[model samples]
Target chain A: MSRRTALAGAVAITALLLQVTVIDRLHLPAGRPDLALVCVVAFALVGGPTYGAVLGFGVGFLADIMPPADHTIGLLALAYAVVGYLAGLVEDVEERSVVTTVLMVGLASAVAVVVFAMIGALLGNAHISLSAVAHSLAATVIYDVVLAPFVVPLVSGAVRHAEPAG
Target chain B: MRDSRRARLVLALLLLTAFTLITLDFRSGGGGPFRTVGNTVFGPIERAVTAVTRPIGSFFASLGHLNSYKSDNAKLRAQNRKLLEELRTSDANRAHLLSLERLDHLAGQAQFRIVAARVVAIGNALDFEWTATIDAGSNDGVRRNQTVINGDGLVGKTLAVGPTTSTIRLGADPEFTAGARLAGTQESGFVDGGGHNPMTFTMLNTRAPLNVGDRLVTAGDTDNHDRPFVPEVPIGRITRVLPTPGQLYRKAVVAPFVDFTSIDIVGVVVAAPRTVPRDSLLPPSPSPTPTPGPGGTGGTGGTGQQSPPPSPGTTSGRRSTSPSPSRTP
Candidate 1:
């Protein structure tokens, strides 16, 4: 595997571990930020659509299988893959402005939350609530916007540095 | 153009992979290989992470509340002393009123071997979902569908069990339901989890006397051992009762005595048990007290003395009239 791919994989696993462990305990007023979501979005922005989609799958799969996860496996993987691919579309822009990047991350986070609930409802989870989706969307957007600036640029810089010479 | 084509191809492949996984997982029944693999690979890491992060989290939390600690400690100490004195007085009175006989009567009604477990994690990503993970699992004799409780009241039941961990769906989850009944009345019904709101209970009989603040307890029908809920466990108190004019049944909202959010230590009843029948099952019926005369005192003394003796041939009839305080509602 390419160094960039390997690094991304490592980061995804670490993000999953942190998401379920420490980040969960952080306990914000709205709710804890989705660390996996942030990482998926950040990496997607850095690596473009294909890389993001693949990374999102890895990360989502990790979450789906993790202990304490009661939902179906790959439900999150599907939701996040779509988010990563969509977020990666911003890479087509010639000059990706700060507002555009933040907005993209926010939008992706909201889409991920809604899509996840919709799919869960489809699978007979019976616990999905529109109000909960909306609340989670709002919280996710705010968290992503705050997190995107730091996470995306750092991941992008690291990936660029680790790029193999032609 | 080639880069875009390659990206599209990769995206398509990933989506297909995701779809295939979802289909396989759904078809294979809950959890499947993905869950086993995930737990095997990630459970230990998560546990270690928790061990490391907990101390740090507590440290920061302690730091944030350092200013209030001294005053709170002093206040708690004074409160503790006052509570100790109150407890002593209550203990003495309770000994006189509720004797060993009464204690045995209560013990006979609760028929389950319980294993205590500690809450290790709350559902975070799925905050809207009512779920938590406890430290004990199959290794500790914990099993799925076992009823979990705290001192105050019913918490929830075990949803899924891992090797060293098990997930509990809190009673506040929308999917949660338990058979329950009003304490003072034979009226039985099912209590449902409210999912962020107070739980709603629907009584089976329309004419069951409805009242606000009436306590509810489990109506343990263990006929279906698959759902082995013990009988007479206190659930909560009714906050509101809504009886529709045309409807045959009444529905009431219950406020659970146990605080779902703050639950720490909990007990899991491991098996369905039968309570030993009390010797004097029937205490008395709710009848008017006669005028306080010599005859009244004599009648009370007679009943009190004979209470412990098993009245012959009245077993079937007396079973229904037992008025043990613990059994009271």
Candidate 2:
């Protein structure tokens, strides 16, 4: 595996652990931030569509099978993969202003939540409700956006550092 | 252009694989080999991470609640004084009840064989599922569907058991439901979790009288094996009685005794008592006067003063009335 891929994998796992053990326990109002999702977006923006989608799938799969996960396996994988691919489509994302990048992260986070909720509804998940979906979407977007300034730059920078020089 | 096509292909392949896995896992009701492997692999890693990060987690949690600490401290001090007074008075009542129990061997509190466990991990907040992983598992005599409780009251029931850890669906989960009975009247009902909101209790008999401040406890299984919940584990108190005209059942909103958000220490009942506990587990009525009747008899007069209804939005830290001190057994 490439050094960049290994770094991404390590980062994703760390984010997953912290997300479940610490962030989830915070019991923040509305909902907790999706740290793994933000990490995926960061990796995607740095590596482009193909790399982003693959990393998203891997991270999502880990989340699905993570302990205490009662939801269907691969649900997160699907959402993250799609979001990663979409995030990579943003041209010159790294070159964009911090404000623009933050906006993109917010947009991607919102899309991921909507896609997950849509699939959950299709699967006849009994817990799905319009209000709940809206609440989660708002919370995810706000938290991810607030978190983007700190996480996105650090993750993307690490990925860039891990890549071989031209 | 080639890279774009390759990306599309990879995305499609991954999406297909995800969909396939989802179908298989869903059809199998989450008992697929993949899930087992996941439990075997990730369970240990999660346990370790939780142990290492618990201090840090609590630090942040305390920081988050820093604003409430001062007010909470004062409120707790006042509550402590009141509880101390109640304890002194309840001592005589407890002794009296013990004598009565010795007189009538059949009427006494159930003794549970419990395995104490610490909560290691919590379910993802993004997902609507409310579950927590406890450190105790089948290796520690924990089993699937066993009742989980804390000093406060009913926590939840074990869902999936690993060798050293188990997953419990919290009572606040939207899908969670348990049989419940009113503490005094013994009017049986079922409690339904409302996710982030308070639980709802539905009485089986439509004409049964319901009142605010009335407490509810686990009804246990009809077979008395206590598969999921043991009888008389204090569930919650009625906050509001919904007026359901023409409905076959009556519904009431319940504020559970155990706060689902910040549960840490828990006990899993490995073996239930030989006899049903009935209302023995409920916290003593808040009234200062101890009822003269036997523990089995309904004592409505002491608890008649209605506890102010908890606001609909507040879901945690509302344990204004102390639970009974005799719940340790």
Runs in model 2 deviating more than 4 A are A164-166, B1-3, B56-109, B125-127, B287-329
**What's the DockQ for every one of the candidates?**
0.40, 0.61
The TM-score measured for candidate 1 stands at 0.73
**Model 2 chain B — which ten-residue stretch has the worst lDDT?**
B99-108
lDDT of 1 at A100: 84
In order, the Cα lDDT scores of the candidates are: 0.67, 0.75
Report the number of the highest-DockQ candidate. Answer: 2
> What are the per-residue Cα lDDT tens digits for candidate 1 across B1-329?
11488778887898789878888888887758777766555655665666576543332222223212222233423433443454454454333223222322332345444555555566655445667776666776777788876655677888667776677878887778999877655468989986656788998877656677677777766575425466666788778987677887789989887777666556666665464232112223244222222222224446566433333455545446868547555
The CAPRI class of candidate 1 is acceptable
Poorly placed runs, candidate 1 (over 4 Å): A25-27, A92-95, A157-166, B1-3, B56-111, B124-127, B224-228, B242-245, B276-329
lDDT of 2 by residue, B1-329 (tens): 12488889999999999899889889998877776676677777877888687643432232223212222233323433443444444554344223222212211235665565667788864657788887776677777888888766888999778877788988988878999998766779899988766799999987556878889988888685678888778889889999999999999999999888878766677777656645787777785322222322234456834533334344343344558545665
Give lDDT: candidate 1, residue B14: 84
TM-score on alpha carbons, each prediction = 0.73, 0.80
Residue A73 lDDT (model 1)? 82
